[model samples]
Target: MKKKIINGFLQILGIMIVGAIIGYSVGKIAGDSLSKVDTPNIILLLIAGVVVFILQVIIHEAGHLVFGLLSGYKFISFRVFDFKIIKDENGKLKIRYERLAGTGGQCLMRAPEYVEGKFKYRLYLLGGVIFNIIFSIVSWLILPSYYTLLFALIGFVLAFLNLIPMGFNDGMTFYHASKDETTRFILHLQLEYIYYQSIGKNLLIEKPEIVEKINSLEITNTNYLTDALEFIKLDGLEYFFEFDALYNESRKLYIERDDLLPVYKVELMALLVKLISLVNPEDELLEELMNDKSLKVRLKQNNPQTKNILATYENGVKLDDEKALNLINEARKIKNKAPNLYIQNLEMKYCDYLENNIIK
Candidate 1:
């Protein structure tokens, strides 16, 4: 809490300094001309500018806090000037707030992990923007022309700018959280294509039982295929092949169509071998897979698909052990080299699995 207060004070102080610099420069440039008119009025404008800047920070963050609470998020802590402190009740930390510098200013609302469902997630993310827009609109109507116009501009900028559908922005997070079906489909198709390419060359390793297992299982729809492919991509061929083999043996049911499988068992075996290489940098399989013509063809064709698949994987899965252990292990090995692609899935999977299998 003390830290938050101090940080808030620093932020306000920084804004004031910047405001002062701008005011001083403007005053120097037009001070003589303005002196001929009204000294007091000019001073008022200067104060207004500084106050507006500071107020902007407060209102912006307040917008986030207001909407966050409305959307059912708990407040952590708030800072005004120059103090930092934390409040805890029964070991549950009180609300916390962090100032987001870019994207028209933002505050992260850390909700409890138990808060699941898309509505809650969406509300939490969009809360600040919504409140900012509302405040801006109201300020424009009520405030005098000078301040009204400024507030309106700030509001418009925050709303539209934050809505850009890209990394770390609200729009991207919202879109992924919403689980737009088209996005999911494209992602699924792309991942399967990548896996197909990765394994196209190693047909010689005859794992008949595994082949027979995957073939027997009923992978009826594109969705299931996508899920299966994602599992393989994250888990690596070793775990996937075992799972597939087990699934096949358990189901012993035929899929309605051959095209449903996308590739044959021999092809899958080769693909797994190729994938095994990429799983770990030090693994021997990389060289052999790299040289294989069929694998190269599939990889080239599937690169785009892989990217989409990765995005979809991120959107749907929240890191858990049973879901993507291989990805987690690889990421752990590489430190910062790990891609954010499957981290969420790995965390959720591990946590859930451990909770159920080990903790329980």
Candidate 2:
């Protein structure tokens, strides 16, 4: 707890320092007109500030798109904070709100396969940063108006802010992922999976091939976020013991992940492992998961199927066949991210295990 708090303090300190530098630079380049804007009301200034901040975020995402396209990467989704622009069932663009912590916005690019020991993904990953810096330079060069300077300065500062390299920030993702073959492979696989899902298709992960390759790799250690995500994408449930080991390795990282969704996901995986295993879980693990504030909040906010699955785990409440079928029906009606197999399998289990039980 002390270490995490210290790290948090250090991160904040670094941001403030970097921010100060950027602010000074912006003032020198763009001047005090931005800070001392002439506005009718304070509320107008606040609203204008919000608008510019959001625009910078959009430009940052656009940077990713531009460079990703340049590098032969295809777009999957673009998110500004919780508002996502992604393809619907008909491959038409659809927008939805999905609030997440530590994410002001994002651009997801589907990468082409990496050639033997050749990684082209660093460009796509770094694309947004590269573009943000470029935009800042352009803004500085153009010597635009004070309001324009506000947009430019925000863009400049936000770009630098993303480079702090901790807690799912751009710099950290780049640092950890750079020149790492295993990590590159994980990225490749993720893109492939996302592509299949985008088209509303089930990606067939060849289990034996992937498992053998993962085993053969000379990995010193596995990253919790990357490896766990890869494992689940590759059907890790079939290899319960291996997934359990990865889960243990990634437990801390998952808990501390910037977003709350991963926390819920890992716990759900743990529960499935317990269901399949002959041995029981330590009571503490279960208690810890249940006590999670994010998971609790997430449970309340999710759609019905997600809510049901978590509810089942939380209460161990078995559903009757009639109720089980109803749940299955309801689940089919609500759309969600693909390959949520826990609910699917559990729904089937409810039918198989509970359907014929005598109710007196």
Q: lDDT per residue, candidate 1, 1-360, as tens digits?
A: 586568657756755675566446544654454455433466666677666655665666676677767766555434433221222323343332222223334443434323123235556666656766787667755643544545555555555545554434666556654565433333333333332322231111233343443444444334322334433433343333353443333222222322222233324433444233223334443456456675454443222223222222322233333343343333334322111223323333433432343223
User: What is residue 34's positional error in candidate 1, in angstroms?
Assistant: 20
lDDT of each: 0.42, 0.59
Clashes of each: 35, 1
List candidate 1 segments past 4 Å from native: 1-50, 77-106, 112-119, 180-360
| 10 residues in a row with least lDDT, candidate 1 | 335-344
lDDT (Cα, 0-100) at 274 in candidate 1: 29
**RMSD in Å for all candidates:** 18.2, 5.4
Per-residue error (Å), model 2, residue 25: 2.4
Q: lDDT winner among the candidates?
A: 2
